[model samples]
Every structure is written in structure tokens, then in C-alpha cells.
Target: MRFGHTFGRWVLDSLLPPRCMLCGEMVDEPGRLCAACWQGLDFIAEPLCPCCGTPFAMPVPAGMLCAACLAKPPRYRRARAALVYGRGGRDLVLRFKRADRTDMAAGLAALMRQAAGPLLHEADLILPVPLHPRRLWRRRFNQSALLAQALGRQAAKPVLLDGLERLRPTPSLGGLNRGERRRALAGAIRVAPGRRALLVGRAVLLVDDVFTTGATAHACIRALLGAGAASVDVLTLTRVVRPDIV
Candidate 1:
């Protein structure tokens, strides 16, 4: 039986060689991504808002904030993304979330490490936005948690998987304006028991796969602050840029 199992594994390996997650060219390792697609990532860098992490062309004349942040500050202290959600980056996120590639989570997490290493070091606890029980049952996995674990592995930080909980199910936020999305997510998150003390006077980094209208991250930030988190930071694989660049 053991010999049969070993032979079966060898056969499976031979039949399906590992491929790059982006272009599907057979790679030396299954989860390995190709150099072209990797380099194709346009990472967000300097001259960013000290609070919201929005990249700006130049530093604000006298302030630490960006124009969008001046108009409306984010709930979290600072947020940074690995890439602007465009063609190739967005395609990878979609594949990871919807197609169950799972492997893509590691790739995204690696990019995030490059984008936000210092932020990870300041964190006392790492929390992934929780999926409501119903969604968890259906999906059988939370993409945020997967990203968090991969990050924890790389950074040697303890990932508090059970520290946050979604209080109830939320309907899909598709087609909703920012305000509508905020209202939908209101009162949706809570800190788990006995874990609240860990956040006191400690910097917390909320992990999520994407940052859209900022509604989801804001909702989680409010809950964490209410639970006594000294401050909150957000890390995401991609940030959605609005169309019609003016």
C-alpha cells in the first residue's frame, strides 16, 4: 500500500508539472510566479499620505496628509498596498478569491511584505477581517486569513486568527456607493472574548485581500478602536483606483 501511494504521487507529479501562477508556464515550483508578471507589478511607493497610504505625486506643502485624506481621513492610521489594482494585479486577486487558486495568496502576501515590512514590525497583533459564518461555510476558506498566515510565516509574527469575529452576514456590496457600503457594514464586527486586552496600547494591522471604497477596512477599524486598540494600520494586496483619471 505504501509503495502504491508513493508511485501514485510520482505519477501525479509527472502528469501535472508546476506552472507559474500568472502565465501558467511550467515552473520549477508549483506556487512560483514568473519574473515578467512579477516585475509587471507597479508597487505604490513614496510621497504617500502618512495616514491613509495614498501615493501622491509630491509631498503636501506643509502637512503629512494627502488631498483625499484632507477631504476625508481613513479610519485606520495608515494603509499601504502592494499594487494599484489594474489589469494584471486585479486578475491575480480575482483568480485567488473566486477561482480557488489558493496558491496566489502566497504570491500576494510576498508582494505585501515588500510594500509594508516596517508596518508589520510595529504590530502587536495581526488580524484578518473575519468572514461571517454563512460565508465561511460556503467558501470553506477566508482569503484574508490565508494572506495573514503567509505573512506571519515570513515575518515570524503571531497571527491572531480568532481575535476578530463577524457578527452577522453582509450582503454583497456590489453596485453600492461608498456611503451605502458603509451603512451596510455598520455593526458588523466584534472582538472575540479575552482577546480585547491584547489590543490595548498596541498597534494592530488589519489584513485584507483588497481595499475598495475603504468601507470594509473602516468598519473593522472602528470595531478594533472601540475595543481599545491604540491605533490601527491596514495592509492590502491591491487598492482599487477609480476610473476617469482626471
Candidate 2:
């Protein structure tokens, strides 16, 4: 069996020589970034806000909350992201989400799994922030759902794709301020009918592609809690980190 597996890998590699996922440069293995691309990614580490996982510029005491988080805490108990949404990360996410690069889901999900850490272990159920049926039809797939499915498999957790529903389509949140984002997503999400039972007394891990102002996460958390979920945490592939938060 071992010999056959090794031979199979050799055949596959010979046919499709291992290359970087970001750049086409040949690498030791497939589904990996080249050293240059890997170095360009800003993976979030410790010394961040405990509530929102916003990385701080300077060293601070552990468990300290950022001013924004302290002033107005997010609905979710905690949030974590794998990468800072900057040049390299942003391009990668955009390609995965907008360019029909579903093949990138596994690689992105691996990063999320590392970032999720204890959140996955503690979550009783995993779910994605839903897209409205109209948008889903247009896109032919929910990017978040793809990430959630991949992460669920890695974590050995049950994924509930239909656990939440988007009640209505909202305008683009791209240019909206924090308050405006909150208003735009208000009442836009809810637990699916007859699906609340799955959430009752469970801790949920909400998955998404990116965390901007967190308007979407807030809405999803409200719906999950209203459905009797004991608690909810958020995990995303990337997030916008503020520079002034030092």
C-alpha cells in the first residue's frame, strides 16, 4: 500500500509538476505558495485584542482589548483571522471569491484552521454566513460555504450549510462606514425556519472569507443567539487591520 501510494504521488507530480498556488513557480509540493509570496502574507499572531483579534502594532500585555472592542464590543464572543487583508492576501481572496477559483478553498481553509485553533475545538457546530438566494444563483456558490465545508472536514466538525438564511438582499457595503454597515445588514440575516433546533444549546463557529467592519458577523451572531445558541465565535481567512491601533 505504501509503495503504491508513493508511486501514485510520483505519477501525479510528473504529470502536473508541483507549483506555487499564488505564483506559477515550481515548488517542492503543490497547493503551496512560493517563499516570496509566503513572506508577503501577514499572518496575524498574538498581542492582539482578545475580543476582535485585531493585531496591535506594538507589544502590549496579553488579553488587553483594543479601544474599539472595549468601547463597543462585537456581538460574537471572539474573532480570529489568518491573514491581514493587504496586498498579497487581498489579491488571493479576491481571486478565490470573484474568479471562480473554488480550487483555492482547501488552501485558504488550511490557513483558517490554523487561525481558528481552539474555536474549532469548542464549537458544537460550524456554519457560514449565508448569501441571498439571488446572489447564490448568480455566483453559483457561496464562498463562505466552501470555506466552511473545507474547514469542517479539517476540524472533524459537523457543518450546517442551511442553518442560517439571508432574509433580503442589501446594497454593497464597500464604502459604508461602520454605523452604515450595521444599518445596512440590520434584519438581513436570521436562523432558517425549523433549523433553530440544531443551534439550541450549541456553540457555533461562524465562517467567512473576510472581516471588514464586522457588520455581517454581528448580524449572524444576533440571529444565532436568538435561535438559542449558547455562544458564537468568528473565524475568517483575512481581516483589515488598522495601522493606528498601536
Candidate 3:
């Protein structure tokens, strides 16, 4: 069996040449970035804001919160992201989300799992931020759902794909400010009917592809809490980390 597996891998590599996921440069393995691309990514690490997981440039006292979190705490208990959403990271996410690169789900989930740390162990269930039916139809797949499923499998936890539902389709929030974004997403999401039981008194790990201003995550967290979820923690593949905040 081992020999057959090795032979199969050799055959596959010969055919596909193990190109890098980001740059398409030939590499040692599939689902990996070239060294240059890897170095270009800013992986979020320690000395981050305890509340929102924003990376701190300079060392601060442990358990310190960022200015934004101090001003307005997010609805979720905590949040973690694997990468800083910059050039390479943003391109990778956009490719996965818009280019039908569902194959990238596993690799992205692996990064999220690493960033999630204790959240995975503490979570009672995994839930993906839902896409409205209209958007889902247009996108063909909810990228968040795909990531949640992959992460749940990695963590050996049950994924509740329909636990939360987007009740209405909102306009693109790309250029909206924080207040506008919040208002736009208000009452746009809810716990799906008949799925609340799974959430009641349970700790949920809310999964998403990217964390921008977190308006979407906050709305989902509110809905999950209202459905009797004990708490919600967020995990995302990437986040926009601002140096000015620290």
C-alpha cells in the first residue's frame, strides 16, 4: 500500500508539476506557496490584541485590547485570523472566493486551524457565516461554508452549515464605513429555524473567509447569541491588520 501510494504521488507530481498555489511556480508540493510568496504573507502571531486578535507591532502588556476593541467591543467573545490581508493574502482569498478554486479550501482551513488555537478545542460546534440564497446562487458556493466544513473536519467537530441563515440580501459593503456597514447588515442574518437547538447553550466557532471591518461577523454573532448560543468566537483565513491601531 505504501509503495502504491508513493507511486501514485510520483505519477501525479510528474503530470501536474506541483506548482505553487499563489504564483504558479513549480514547488516541492501542491497547496504550498513559493518561498517568495510565503515570505510576502504576514502571518498573524503573538502579542496581539486579546479581544480582536489584531497584530501588535510593538510589544505590549499581555491581554491588552486594541483601541477599536476598547472603544467598541465586538459581539463575539474573541476573534483570530491566520494572515494579514495584504497583497498576497488578498489575492489568494479573492482567488479562492471568486475563481472557483474550491480546492484551496483545505489549505486555507489548515491556516485557520493553526490560528484558532484553543478556540477549536473549546468550541461545541462550528458554524459558517451564511450567504443569502440569491448571492449563494450567484456564487454557486458559500466560500465560508466550504472553509467551515474543512476546519470542522480538521478539528473533529460537527459543522452546522445551516445554523445561521442570511434573511435578506444586502448591497455590497466594500466601500462602506464602519457605521454604514453595521447599519447595512443589521437584521440581515438570523439563526435558521429548527437549528437553534444545536446552538442552545453551546460554544460556537464562527468561520469566515476574511475579516475586514467585522460588521458581518458582529451581526452573525448577535444572531447566534440571540438563538441561545452560550458564546461565539470567530476564526477567519485572513484579516486586515492596521498598524495605526496598535
lDDT of each: 0.82, 0.89, 0.89
For model 1, how does the per-residue alpha-carbon lDDT over 176-239 read when each residue is reduced to its tens digit?
9999999999998888889888888878989998888899998888889999999999999999
Model 2 spans with C-alpha error above 4 angstroms = 1-15, 244-246
Q: For each predicted model, how many residue pairs clash, with residues at least 3 apart or on different chains?
A: 0, 0, 0
Higher-TM-score candidate among 1 and 2? 2
Clashing pairs in 2: none
Expressed as tens digits, the lDDT of each residue in 156-233 for candidate 3 is 999999989988999999999989999999999999999988889999999998999999998999999999999999
TM-score of 3: 0.91
- For candidate 1, the per-residue lDDT at 228 reads 95
Better of 1 and 2 by lDDT: 2
Residue 71's lDDT within candidate 3 is 91
Better of 1 and 3 by TM-score: 3
lDDT of 2 by residue, 1-246 (tens): 646865776687669977776777888866578899999899998777888898888888877889888888778989999999997889888888887666678888998888887899999999999999999988878999999999989889999999999999989999999899999999999999999999999999999999999999999999999999999999999999887464
